[model samples]
Target chain A: MSKEKKKPILPMIIFGIVSLGSYFVLFNQEGLVTETYTKGGWYAAFPILTAFWFSFVHGSFGSNLLDVVGLQAKKNK
Target chain B: MRKVAAVLIVILMILPMATAVFAGGPPPKNLKKGIFLEVNEAAGTALFQDSTTQETSTLMIGYSVKAEDLKLNKKMMVSFEEHDGQVFIKTAEVMFLDLTLTKFISLIVVGLVGGLLSGFIGSGGAFVLTPAMMSLGVPGAIAVASNMCHKFPKALVGSIKRYKYGQVDIKLGLVMAVSAIAGVQIGIKIQKVVLDAWGNAGSNLYVSVVFVVVLVIVGGYVLRDAFKLSKNPAAADTQSKLSLRLQKINLPPMMHFKTAGVTMSAWITLPIGLATGMLAATIAVGGFIGVPGMIYVCGASAIVASATELVVAFVMGTYGSIQWAVSGLVDIRMTLLILSASLIGVQLGAIGTTYVKDYTIKLVMAATMLVVAVSRGAKIPVYLQDLDWATLSPTTTAVLNGISFWALIAALATAGIIITGAMIKGMREAKQEVQVEESHSKA
Candidate 1:
């Protein structure tokens, strides 16, 4: 119970904020993002690279959120 | 030896079909990637700038495509046919879809469940997501492209999670993935031949039929095995006799996968990978065939087979996404929206596996595959009607479409229920055991 109480809220919040920020930026600039992304050449990298960014940032936030909620894998030992 | 011979015979069989396609088939339809430069409403013609060559050509827009709907300067994918020295556009789809509130929520919901399914069973979502997005009014190519763009990263996250639990075999996954790419080429070739002969409706019918047949046979076998394994938990970790026999074969270039604990001839794995790729190209669900082939043919246990398949999915998804993105077909907005939920779902699913037995994974997969088969089966009549082979009233067509779409929803719902139920039950049992051990040690 004490260990549960000690779980960090700070990093989770930080990650959550950044994840939300990234999504906001993309949506807010939807027109530019779409135009640049669909340029059909070197611009193709924009979407692929952006996907990688969200996966890492948002993925980390998800990990922390799950941990805070007490869901975890069983230890073999 | 006979099993190996049978696999060889199957490949040989596919060769003739490939040759037959090449020898005498209707001209393949031209699916070009380009942007609309100018739309002349009066002539029902549009000037298109080809994405690849930067060449501008005039295309006659079919009556089905409204001129008002054409968006100039937007990247588009056009399906056309060359007739008597002129290009005729059958369909022109703007690659990027408008992200509406309804579409946004739907992508997240589907992404989360699909991710969970993929994480738990090793293969899922593609069969359901593409159709689900299409139902939400996204064009078929955009839906497929965006779903694929989201898949590789989800697979990467899921595979990494499973790998931490000592479930993945990179060597095995890489071997299968490389061979599978070759299979994709052949599958694409076959699809082109079908498209040339019967056009869009025919192509859809071909895909649906293959989807139904493959899912029924493979899913049925896995379900029966799941039942057997559940009845006798002690045998859950045992390898099939086929794997044992194949391991004994003295073929050269034997590759031993440490995590899967299998050592077999390299020759044996290639055919399975190729078959998986072919299935993937034809149906857009390679993982469906890949995981099962790994288990039944390569002799890997279900747990290892499913986990290794994540590696294959990651590789194939990345490769496929690049191909789509290069043509500017990927709707990044949709891809990100889905990933927003799926990344989380995938990780949760990966952890859930640690609580349950291998049979649980097989059971979830079997359930998903069987229900998904029903979903595709319901669409067969609709496609038949489109081909004019069968006449149906408008109401019947609407009813069939409803059945097809709802059946997909049902498959997702069923799989979600079973996976969550199994995970909860398993997690509760694990916690109780941990508490008991802690108390005993303290006392």
Candidate 2:
């Protein structure tokens, strides 16, 4: 099922960089990002936006982390 | 091909019919819909107008409030009188719309960790998210709504990953999800009634009691089973006698599940799903019982049972999110924030399953269940005090609350460590095997 292709490493590296960058932007400076999220109502937009942002970025990081560590699910078909 | 088409048709038909049947109740006639105009204490009436119908109505809001404290001009919500009766302002809570950057960061951090935990355990981290949101000044209903909104997508992602690994039983999951949704509706009704009659403190006490009792009993049984299997790994493969007997019951309308490799009466499966849904509504930990019930009672292996639970969670979560969204209570931020980490966490957990023996899942599940039981159990005394049944010292109350919160953190940490350790070991072994095969091919 793998088709013997060369394992792609760049996607994993790009994901890592972006994930860390987002984390820094959100967490730096007296928790401004978190404070804005809890202000309620329309401020809730902050949390929703960040969540999607992290899901793509961190999700890719995790997926590739598994790949780099040689932990893919067995291809039984 | 005919059989496949027949199955698809049955699914399509049942999906709508089941929804219509479950949605049988009439809409709340006394549901007050309006924005508050003024609070008049002398007449004890809160002036409100229906936003949709554009009808002005003076609603005798059931609860008492001070006249001067009413906020005007902001969109305030109100509920109704008898069927086709006058609408009254129920409780006009303020809707604020300012968020600092700090809350955004916290949601991501919490969401990532929560997602990671959910990915690993199949259930958890949500209990903390709801409370965390509430602590961050979100209302109780909104916290739950936001959390529910996030859950379905996370479960969907997790279920797909596990399905790829040959772990999910789609047929079993659908059956369970359908029944579970019914259970949730009933559970919600019961909860609403309790809250109305007994008030918040009483409702909280009741929830704690159920959480403590169910978790302890279920957790104990699972722990015992895990220990037994650890002592004799071969025993994991053996079918339980009860399940063996259940398989023999030649009842009509029997259903077959390929991944689960079992065919049983629809009647048998429905109750399990119902219980899962009801418990989910009550405690938000449906997977805790759902997975074990499928394994021990329904006789599927832990791998398939736990994986199938993701599908059930997805279906239920989506329904719940829509309901919450309709009310505009779902804080999309909280939902997506949790999804961020949880999506990844679930994938990792699904893959982790491939490396461990069936008994290992049991061990992790039992350990989590038991520890979480302790967390809930610690809160019982606090609830009892709230009910005024017992008088406790302030220090003792504080200590118990601390223990309850910390225990939850401990449970997550322990589960995370164990799952990561097991996955690492499995990955190493798999790589060694791959290397061996490559060298052999070269030779």
Candidate 3:
């Protein structure tokens, strides 16, 4: 159980850093991002791709963060 | 295990085929695209620009219309009429640019709170989110589409978090989602029949009535049950008679859900999902029914039911998002902005679940539902006025709209408090348990 618990921590920390870093870029650079993205046609892929990309990265960060905080579901019913 | 996996794959493969066959006709292309440069009333023609290419064009009027009909400098979608070999935009309806910075901020805030509520209660945020978007000046279709796009990823994250906490029943949730998709098709068909008969106002009235009535009835029952359970604290952990009766069906092709701890016929399971999908299509919140159906009809405990809802949400949301994305209506910035906060909120709510009993979910869900019913109830009068069935003074109309908006805000805030309070209490108790257990092990 301890081993299982420890496994998620390192990945969580790494993901956390990356997740926060990406947001810093996206939110701060909203003008450039929005301008480039809303150009229409093929460029529309920017917003869609970005949504999916965050789902994975931010999602992982959240999952690991929970595990690192020792908040896991009870094991073995 | 392999056989179980095989069944899952088979069920998944059949769902899309079923939806395509039964989901009825495609959504109407109500998009009217054009830009106006000038209104020429003398010739009854408007100098307009095509939205796509921005090319200038002249359209002659078919009906007798004045220059004042066109709102100058405002881009409008015009109904075209060809008269005397010349095309004219007959009715120049301005394309409303209702999106404001304030609305954008409101969307993000509502999305975050809704995400938190969803994480705790299984499915709710959309019921409120869609209306919130509408109030923010998003067109009805765009609001629903954008909300759907946000839903899938939010559900994905929420599901994973809850799944980690032993709340999700993957096989069961997937099976229900398939049936729910089929149900959405049926619901859409029914909507078309109503539309054909009574037109748009009638359809809107029908939807509002259904939302008000269903939410009131179901929400009331749930509230009563929650109250009763609270009174008898020991009963909080027990399953209901309806749940037990559902568990005893034992018909052929009975499926076992180990986590939910129930086995029932696919027949029993399919209808719940169908109802969920139908409601989702109407109100954009399928999980409200889906969660309760699992608890009362399928005999799953609240924990599993809520967790599984995230799965259903993920599936439905994904399909719904794809439909919206294809229409090019999804505003990705809005989707991401909401996700940023919601991802964190969902994680917090999911972990919060581990610290409370099943009834806590019930408490939050019932409260949210009842408050939301009030919000929708407030809108009935406005729709009534729209259809000319009833007349309201401006003050009354403003008051009604105000109450409707504030009630929605109240619902969000109420749910937020309940969830937060319960989570904190649960966390404290969980910490105590861990400390006690550690001491015992040391001794």
DockQ each:
0.55, 0.16, 0.31
Worst 10 residues of 3 chain B by lDDT: B19-28
- Model 1, global lDDT: 0.82
Global Cα lDDT for candidate 3: 0.74
Interface RMSD of 1: 1.9
Q: Is the docking of candidate 3 incorrect, acceptable, medium or high quality?
A: acceptable
Give model 1's docking category: medium
lDDT of 3 by residue, A1-77 (tens): 32353458788888878878887787677656644553344654665567677888988987777677766554432
TM-score of candidate 3 against the unseen true structure: 0.84
Q: Which candidate is the best by DockQ?
A: 1
DockQ of model 2 vs. true complex: 0.16
lDDT accuracy of residue B413 in candidate 1: 91
Task: List residue ranges in candidate 2 displaced over 4 A.
Answer: A1-4, A8-71, A74-77, B1-102, B436-443
Q: List TM-score per model, in order.
A: 0.89, 0.77, 0.84
lDDT of each: 0.82, 0.70, 0.74
Show where candidate 3 strays beyond 4 Å: A1-49, A64-77, B15-28, B33-104, B438-443
lDDT of each residue in B1-443, candidate 1, tens digit only:
45445544654455434322110111223567778989998888889898678899887875557687778987777786666776677677776667788888998999999999888888788778888988877787777778888998899988998999999987788778777877877887898899889998999999999999999999999999999999999988778787788889879888777888888898888889989888888887887888888887788878888889999888777767766666566788899999999999999888888888889988988988988899889889989989999988889888988888898889889988988998899889988988888888789
* Candidate 2 residue-wise lDDT at B404: 87
Better of 2 and 3 by DockQ: 3
